[model samples]
Target: MARPTFRELTAQALSSVEHGYDLLAPKFDHTPYRTPDRVLNATVRVLRPYGPFGTGLDLCCGTGAGARVLRAVCRKRMTGLDFSAGMLDRARSAAPDGTWVRGNALALPFAPGSFDLVVSFGAHGHFLPRERPRLFAAVRTALRPGGRFAFPLAAPARPGTPAYWSLLAFDTAMRVRNAVWRPPFVMYYRTWPLTDVRRELRAAGFGVTLHPLSELGVRPDGSPRCRLVLATRLPEHSG
Candidate 1:
């Protein structure tokens, strides 16, 4: 796949989240925004002990990166859901064996206790911090007791570092762009901090655990560069 041109990206940046993804769907894999294979592979390695699940879902499964990971860990059905039709079309074509559905993440179009494993990749930035509770509640409702909701989160860059400034600049620019733009694109690099995310998951009826992805390497500070958040849904009577 060829990379999207600057004009194409500019157009996408100006469009609504769904429309922007639809426009970028064809060449999304060629971009750095796509989840890298190492991340997917490492996720598979970590999930193997917890899975071989009956059914799996890839929430916000842009172009099927996470769905492909499910294929390795899940024994039965594999489904991918995204709000963008164009992205779903590409995902369906690339992985025809899996099912693809178009729906909003906030209100997933699945029955309660429908899946045993759910994974998402590179789609968290599309959601606002306030919207996380509703989003996580929906995921919890869709999962059976003991089912898991998993996603990767990287360590925050240290303050005053070049990487830190770069992220701060990108988020600041996005805030400015959204202030002037309609149907704001909600992509913020610094929003999904691990502490807040774990608290929200616990409140959403999940027992949260962090598994270090050492294959991705560690920071100079000796912390893993990335960790997979495994939030298992608890039974109704359990906390």
Candidate 2:
């Protein structure tokens, strides 16, 4: 895929999230926003020991990057769902063997106990903090007892660092843009803190654990640069 031009990205940034992704779909994999192969490979390697899962779902699966991970770990079947039809179209072509469905993450269209493993990649920024409870509840409802939900959460950049300042600037600019714009493009790097996420997952009936993605290496602080969050759905009877 060719990289989107400056003009193209500017157009996308101005459009609504769904319309923006639709416009960018053809060139999405070439964008930096696409989940890197290193991340996907690390996720697959770390998840292999837990799987050979019966069925899997890739929530908000954009262009099927997570589906590729699911393919390696899931035995029975894999499904990818996203709200953007254009993304689902690209995902279908990229991984024709897997099932692709168009749906919102806050209200997953699958039945209760539909999957044994659910994974998401690079789609959290699309959701707002207020929407997380409903989003997690939907995922929990879609997973069977003992099913797992996994996603990578990177350690936040230290204050005063270039990366930290850059992310802060970008988020601030987005807040200003959304303040004046209609149908905001909600992608903030700092909103989904790991602490809040863990609390919410436990509240939603998932027992959460963190596995360091050591392959991605550690930060200067000796913390893993990224950790994979594995949230298992607790049985109805268990705490």
Maximum-lDDT candidate: 1
For all candidates, what are the clash counts? 0, 0
lDDT of 2 by residue, 153-237 (tens): 9999999999999999999999999999988998899989999999999999999999999989999879999999999999977
RMSD of each: 0.8, 0.9
Which 10 consecutive positions of candidate 2 have the poorest summed lDDT?
230-239
- lDDT per residue (tens digit) for residues 89-153 in model 1: 99999999999999999999999999999999998888999999999999999999999999999
Question: Residue 197, candidate 1: how far off, in angstroms?
Answer: 0.5
| Collision count of model 1 | 0
Question: Model 1 TM-score?
Answer: 0.98
Clashing pairs in 1: none
